[model samples]
Target: MIATVVSSYPKIPNRPSPARLRNAINRFDRGAITEEEIRRIEDEVTEEALQQQAEAGLDLVTDGQIRWEDEQTYLARQLNGISLNGLTRWFDTNMYYRQPVIEGAITWQKPITVDDYRFAVEHSEKPVKAVLTGPYTLARLSVDQHYGSVGALAKAYAGALNREAKALQEAGATLIQFNEPAILQHKREFEQFAGLCRSLVDGITVETSLYLYFGDAEGIYPQILDLPFQLIGLDFVMGAKNEALLQSAPFTKKLGLGIIDARNTKLESVDEIAERIRSLAAGLASDQIHVSPSAGLEFLPREVAQEKLRRLAQGVRQAEAVLV
Candidate 1:
């Protein structure tokens, strides 16, 4: 079994915080700080985030999305015909995301995250997985003035995502993940959601995965298993019923078991986590399981997040040892 993060990792200690970064951006915008200084800060933060993932003994690493303002706005602003509109509470979290405004036909004019993905690949010792927000989530979070309906908007965004995924694949990314947390909110559109995701990955050759978090997936179980993804990630921490759902469904693809809680500050017991992994492995097989936090580790403090990563890696290792 391998360990990896779904997306953003918490900022490291004593480093320039997100608030500081935003302030720097504000200064740069107002011509108080030079563009070169902002780039230098971004590079430094990304390098540290990569180093922390590698140090955690993770098999797959990400840039920790340190450069992103939030999940939606960063990528939304990068695409053509889309702009950052206003703030909205992201799900039930205290954090806010800049709601995307669709002013015209959405198109992928240029690579948004390819440069960042390449930077992570260049800095990290381990293999890096390129992460992107899924089309459904992007469409759902956006204020669609151009596209008539949510389905139409999602499909348009799917094409853009497909183009981006292929670009990342050509840039030497073997693993690509599309995070669709919004799917849990719209369970009635399971078939349409699956079709949109299929269109997003249509002809991409790289290994692909889907990560759903922040909500229970009990209602959409079995149906989601039918999606064409090499791996499927589920939040077992937030959705305790997922264990039974997995038993009831026939899951053949790789399973990214989110056993660690990322939102809470309380630490998880390595032994208990390992035991749960052992139980899941009894039916799913240890080789098909990949362990990670239930969601991004950005909510917790730096030290606590680091400890969680260590515990996650240790717990997975211990579980695999028991299976061996």
Candidate 2:
């Protein structure tokens, strides 16, 4: 079994702290700091995140998205016809992301996340997974002034995402993941969203995954299982309905079992996590299961996040032993 994070790791411990980085970004915008200095800070943080994941012994790792301002705004800013308008609360978190304003037709101007993925690959011994915000989530989160409707915006976003996914694949990314936390709110448009996800990965040869969190997935479980993704991640911690959903639905794809709660500060025992995985493993192949925090580790403190990762790795090992 593989142990990994869904997306986003905590920021580097110190030296180029969040405050310092924010100041650097502000300085760069005001022409007080050079672009090279900003790049240096980003590289330092990215390397620290990668090293932390490596030290924790994860089977698959992510770039930790250190350079990202927020999940959607960073990628949205790279596309044409979208502007960062103002601050908006991100989901239920204390943090905020600049709201993406869709002013006109959306088009991919350049590779958004490929360079970061490549950087992580070069710095780490572990294989890196290229992570992107899904088309559905991007469309749902952005203010749609030009697209007229969510469906049209999603379609446009999918095409742009396809270009980015292909770029990551070419950059030696064997695994690609699209984060669509907004899908939980748009359950009625399941079919349309599924098709959009398919469009995003049309010609990509690498393994693809769709990670849904922050809400219940039980209502759309059976339908979501049919999506073209090779893996489906469900937040069992937040979505208590997922337990019944998993039991009732036919889960043919690999399961990213979210047993650790990323939002909560209290540490979960490795034995408890292992038991949850063991129970889920009874219904699926041992190799088909992957363990992760219920969502991104960004909600926790840096030291807490690192300990959670260690527990995740230990829990997977214990669960796999039972399965064997």
Q: Model 1 clash tally?
A: 0
The residue-level lDDT of candidate 1 at 253 comes to: 87
Model 1: per-residue lDDT, tens digit, 124-160?
Answer: 8988899999999999999999999999999999999
Question: How many clashes in each structure?
Answer: 0, 0
Candidate 1 local lDDT, residue 123: 89
What stretches of model 1 exceed 4 Å from their correct place? 12-23, 26-30
- The TM-score between candidate 2 and the true structure equals 0.95
TM-score of each: 0.95, 0.95
Q: After superposition, how far is residue 290 of candidate 1 from its true place, in Å?
A: 1.1
